[model samples]
Target chain A: MRRREALLHIGSWMVTGAAALSAGRARAARAAPLDQPSVRATIDNLFPDLPIDTSDAVAIEGPEITDDGAHVPVRLRLGTQRDTPHRIALVASANPHPLVATLDLGERFSGPLALRIKLARSQSVILLAATGQRLYAATTFLKIVASGCNPGQDETPPTDLGTIRFRHDPPREGMADARLLIRHPMRVEQRDASDIVSRPANHITMINVDIDGNPLLGMACGQSVAADPYLAFRLRTPQAGETLEIGWRDTQGRGGDARFPLGI
Target chain B: MSLDRRDALKAGAALALSSLLPACATPLRTPPTGRVVVVGAGWGGATTARYLRRWAPSVEVTVVEPARAFVSCPQSNLVLSGGRNLASLTLDYGRWAADNGIRLVRDTVRDIDPERRRVQLAGGGQLEYDRLVLSPGVDFDYAAVPGLEGEAAQARVPHAWKAGPQTAALRARLEAMPDGGVFVMTIPAAPYRCPPGPYERASLVATYLARHKPRAKLIVLDANPDIISKKGLFRAAWRELYPTLIEYRPSNAVLQVDTDRLTVRSEFEDLRADVLNVIPPQRAGDIARRAGALGEGERWARVNFIDYRAERVDGIHVIGDATLSTPAPKSGHVANQQGKVLAAALADHFAGRDPYRDPVLSNTCYSFVSNDEAFNVAAVYRVAEGGKGLRLADGSSGVSQARSSEEAALARAWATNIWSDMLG
Candidate 1:
């Protein structure tokens, strides 16, 4: 996804080079696939064998620009087509640590899902949906005013660090979706350790999910997680003697736990 | 103390196109005519609507606002201090709707279709316009202070930043406080609604607690490194007025909040209070940000200073506190002036003439240090190099040299004049 490679890729496909070139950097920006080298490399590394197809049916719906990079609201919409995607992933090209989120759309999962994610700087936010063997992408550029960060780690001190709330769907066909709202600034400290002014990188680092006295899963978040992070995942419907609990630890090593009792 | 500070600040600043007669620009002036959609009926949106009616009658206008009443943020702190009642700060928009010949739609703009020039309403249906003016105020960012958001959380720790039931709720909670109880309030970083606002609130609350709850103490937890606005005056007033009761803590960022225990956790310390007022960070209103007007990394809308148009969208303009109009404090006076200037700019543009690229706008903010004494600051912002937004007219802004009763009266008068201009 180097600039030269992107230009060559643009020459092979997409809108006419003349029209894109006439747009004045439009070819490099809008028309070029994989404008971001690292993001493209990551995707290629993840699914090197899978073919990625560009589709207009996939849309990254959010503001064209936002004043705050900490919590940019976006919605992932998939076309009402047969064999819809089973997984969705979002990446911010300019984010310090891309790969904002990777979610599995489990059985009974449906429609456009809403999200609020953090961005390190101004850049195109790429949304990729994987269905069958192809990856569909939709991107929109955001211009940031004052930059904020949640680098790759969080170091927020464990003090009244917000609260944790959750919403769990009633079991349908032995599967339920759980949305966890963990409150944290998800601040990203500057990579340069010698910087004087401490830009508070108070982001959440780890979340542990325990259901029915068994460990469910864990998420290792980066700077791309929004403030007061809201995350969704799927879990098996609790059976006899099952207890559901969730816990999270922020970068500052502060943590909280919550329990959802069994359904009668 | 003197208006001369403002007058002196603008000396030798290059202010281009301060006087541009539409007639002179175009001899054959086509009467301006087009539909203008305005969202939020606060001082900024309301003033734009009224002025458009006055200056450009033919331009059809419709304002979309969810709230039925206009709450004045400028004086809500007075309500906390008992200098004014909530009723005085709240004004009904009925008169504005009745007199302005503008269609007032009582609805929220859920989405904006920039290409289609249409705004989808929350309840349903769409309002199409040739131009859209967004003045939705600010929305609180509560990630930094967790477990203290939403209705249930707000019920416990009332920010009272917005003027309405929250303000009344905080007042009632304060009134119910025991004389020996501890009241704590936290201020977020800068680029918030008003520069000197948190201090004004701190000052007003200090005055109230000292008089009624004499034995009680108030803690001012400020996240910023220093007092942001009118520092000298606020510092002096705090030292002279309620030195014992008010403890000003600077650079103290509230890391977390535990509502169950009513405690605030910050770096190096933890404070428990009977009444906690946490003013969390804020960003542009949800709908305004959805319009893609605000830039990334910042929380307010970025606009062309000349016309207040959103940089991302062609015919949409954003004003008020939700805008990132730096070098210009987010005050009522600045928003109102931006509205008038934008109104004229749109009028002239519709008349087939270009709006000046680098127009000048001024802001005069008066903050009450007490019920009788106040301090004021004023400045003019001109378009920066290459018409890039605005910068303070060099040396043109200053905080008042002193606080006085006359300035306090002027502060009250300022509210009446601005209210009339928006609603009369």
Candidate 2:
């Protein structure tokens, strides 16, 4: 949908009183959807035809002021509504590439996900959750003490590339936590101090995990994802002796896979 | 002066009325009733002073420092590579002092009389304090290194550890050296000021040599048995980027330095250099010793980890590199965290509350592998069981997985935030 049409459709999808209140603020933010033209383009491209919901259903938790813009920890809590979102996207508005990551949470996963991302400067970090037909968005502001230097593009990857470490907590009250760490540089095009911009950005483009021969979760990462990217999420009813097959592929066409047994 | 309830209430009201009457011309002396005297205005002392005022608005804070401005030792190594200059690192305390209501005293402590709670100044002055905070950072043990006895000897081969004139001198020496010149630096053992500092210095110097004079060589003589902090990262950088330019020899302790020949002698090898950087083993600053804070023959001062009170002496507390050790590294970040801990403890004590039994401090030291890439070793320290001192919190610390330009940017951000936390 066009920006004007998205704004018009905002009134039709107001589900709760909280959603209506945000719809009012959405109209105010309508004066300028995003400060940067590239950022607006990114948002419009992500949701071309769907009307975005500015609702309390999506929650973003991050530091109000971050000392290190290179790695800022963030958590997103999707609402407890029975209708779980099919997809989630995170964006740092002013980054060289606004889109940080998009996760296809699969049909069964209702998440409280956590990750660390890179920010270029002080700006709004927006989280969007897509429920197939409808989209919900939340935003939080972060002030960078010192802005992150623009990252340099494809350098030689570390020698221990494709190394993966996976861990999971014991099931507690029908919920278990799992974290995955991948050894990838997540290289992106960056400008040097001498104003020299350097090659092809290389980052983990796809991540998929399967448990007990069933699809658990999948994520598509971007350059704004920090190096040695980490992803953590909760699992429901994780059973003993269950096998988890994890696979990921990078922009450079190199890939790695690992198998971790649950309840170890 | 025991009083009945009615009499005490009457006296309190009368005192309150008298205090209100004085507000017309003289502002009521309602400032916090306690006074804290802090010695040495480095990261530790300055942060303690600012935080004491922040936590307890009424408490008077006085800081005695010899230096006119603060020059950060954290990122000073970059000066050798021309990535940053001393001017950019040097900061004035005028604004920070004024805003925090911190009284700045330009003097050094000659001695401390703990019984009288008095601090004697070298400038023929004495300061009485209800509580004394000693954050006098590390003092190099020059006597340990034969032939490097006093100021005259240090002039020839600058330690450049404190990041001031000596740092500038070291940079100038590097600049003036001819091609194929050997730049050798010696690292003191573990428990020095900054664990990864020497390695970072070597890394940056090697970077400069590679860019300017590829034939020049940089030798690292580490006294420790192995690479200490960010070992894998530093080792990899030296191997990958500066394989030919840098030579790292661990377990090589310097025995002596001949300034005339610019040669350093360890037990195994004697190497001559066009420029020599000798970092001497360090102990608590002189004032810490004068205050009788350190135990017999102890290099560092022992303190009650709960509130950081000196163990051997009464009425004195030590923080930073002066304290008798913990798992926390002796870096600016730890000192700043210690300052906040001490300040909060004092605030609690004055408020008739007990200090926190298990205070936690987090430290992060970022070291540059080159001009554009860096890595960090971070830890969260909590009071160990039985409260002897601090230990690394279980699974609460780790080093960066790799070196990258992103980390270098974060390193700059870390320094900027920490410097601001201490003085801004």
Candidate 3:
């Protein structure tokens, strides 16, 4: 009788363990949606006519969990092909605006394009890649434990733009790196802590880089860029004593330009 | 070598005495030694350099600053309302360097030799150091706005974004305008320095108009549909204090500024103003890019919270306006706190001591809504893992929920405290 009772007890324990395991699996299966419907609609509306082929060729690399959502490091990689990919775009479904960044390779670049994206809340991001009329894509959901969208209580009206200076990275022969600095209170439009209705978005919209009177790169940016945006890119042919001109424009129609001599 | 009986007895006696004096022999306190070269002498760089010297006296510290004086951005907003003079806000770094034994070099940094651990000054002097600290502030992107350039900024318009002579120039322009003249201040999009700064300037300008020139209305043309920070407080204060003097129009994107005609052209309409405070969009300090600190299309440096070191490079530390520190707004308070934390970490490294773990930092920013009232926000941060950065401690950082009468008074007090902390 005692042996029979012990067997029954062991059997009950096994049954309970199996039940907990199944419960955990069920929770994992019910993964939260990464992209909201509104964000998906925006993505679709932006590219209405094109047939977006959702495939694994394009991957969005982001942390499964992010501590700060304001400036998340997002890397978009396209599949290695015999030729360069035709079009690559990045869309953050959870941001106030769906399209965070868009890049057209223009038949020249091949390596992965890395940029930072702003997240209003924790949401999944999708990377869409097009190669030779074929669209391939992948998605990664980032669980943002902290919200970067609403500075919440961290907003301080900056009193100083501070001192401006230029420094080059890897001061080597043939290769040079540079960054431009400015100071302003970069206020996003979505915060409502002051009980004011919705705040308007004020951000830098355009950046133009000219080397020796020739335009090297031009871009149109939005609030998705972090405060004190630090734009960096590689110059394939850096020659010493050449002049590098940079200019920036804000939505307010106010801008400034600086000329720095390249010390290659 | 053989020792005689007498000599052996003496040696044994000496060894016994050494064992007894264990406390005196406790590992010679060899304070760690190193060199830290800091670029830019703003709140971030200044505090970091100061703390580094205080924490590690043996470490040689040098700060490269081109500016002879440091005028704080925190309290400069009061200048628009005629509350303070530029001289009151300006600071000198001579005391910090001389008294603290930090080598203050007044020279522009041309380039950073990360490999050789040296910095090339603009004057052709190469200074070698083990660690480099960069806190150079932001730069403006002029091409974003058409018809706004160098001559336009100097003669016709003023961004006054960098507080100093330009800030004084802007105030002079506003005061010189006629009583009924229009004061136009354009707000940039997100991710600029001081989120509420533009609004504060607008409020101060409106205040000026309310008392001296009631007919001279302040028009705030913002790019976004909403104000960035303290919108409720600002709107409430404006409505109550200077209702007729201030008009805020959201989403009125200024396409360009015609300095000659004194008109700001927006996407929807064109408005004429006597004074145009066109705050332009901005980017990271140029030094970060020169040092290859930022990622592709990244306008800020990627830094590790452990030591505020650049994630891309090993021996370089990037702080202040250049780092891409999310969750923490780009404010002088945050920069100063980061400098202190980095100083402690550097000291630990030099002394062969285990670095202090999990530093807690605090930041509080006060925006004066009126001469009598101000809005305040404060937070405490801690480093978290998983490639993610700092996280705010619960119940540590928050905004004044209702803008209580007492809270406004406290805000002013906080402002005074911050200035003292940064400069004093």
Q: Which prediction has the highest TM-score against the true structure?
A: 3
User: Tens digit of lDDT per residue, candidate 3, span B231-263?
Assistant: 777778777878788888654557788888888
| DockQ of candidate model 1 | 0.03
Q: Regarding TM-score, does 1 or 3 come out ahead?
A: 3
Residue B138 of model 3 has an lDDT of 87
Which numbered prediction scores highest in lDDT against the true structure? 2
lDDT of 2 by residue, B8-112 (tens): 335434532432232222211596578899998898999888778777777788999988899999999999998889998999876666666778899998989
Instruction: Return the lDDT, model 1, position B314.
Output: 84
Model 1: CA > 4 A from native: A1-264, B1-32, B295-297
Which of 1 and 2 is ahead in DockQ? 1
Residue lDDT tens for model 1, B181-222: 999888886668887888999889887898899999998888
Stretches of candidate 3 off by over 4 Å are: A1-120, A127-264, B1-32, B151-155, B401-416
Task: Show the lowest summed lDDT stretch of 10 residues, model 3 chain B.
Answer: B19-28
Worst 10 residues of 2 chain A by lDDT: A11-20
iRMS per model, in Å, is 10.2, 16.7, 13.0
Q: Count clashing residue pairs in model 3.
A: 63
Return the DockQ of model 3: 0.03
TM-scores for all candidates: the values are 0.60, 0.58, 0.64
Clashing pairs in 2: A1-A48, A1-A49, A151-A190, B32-B58
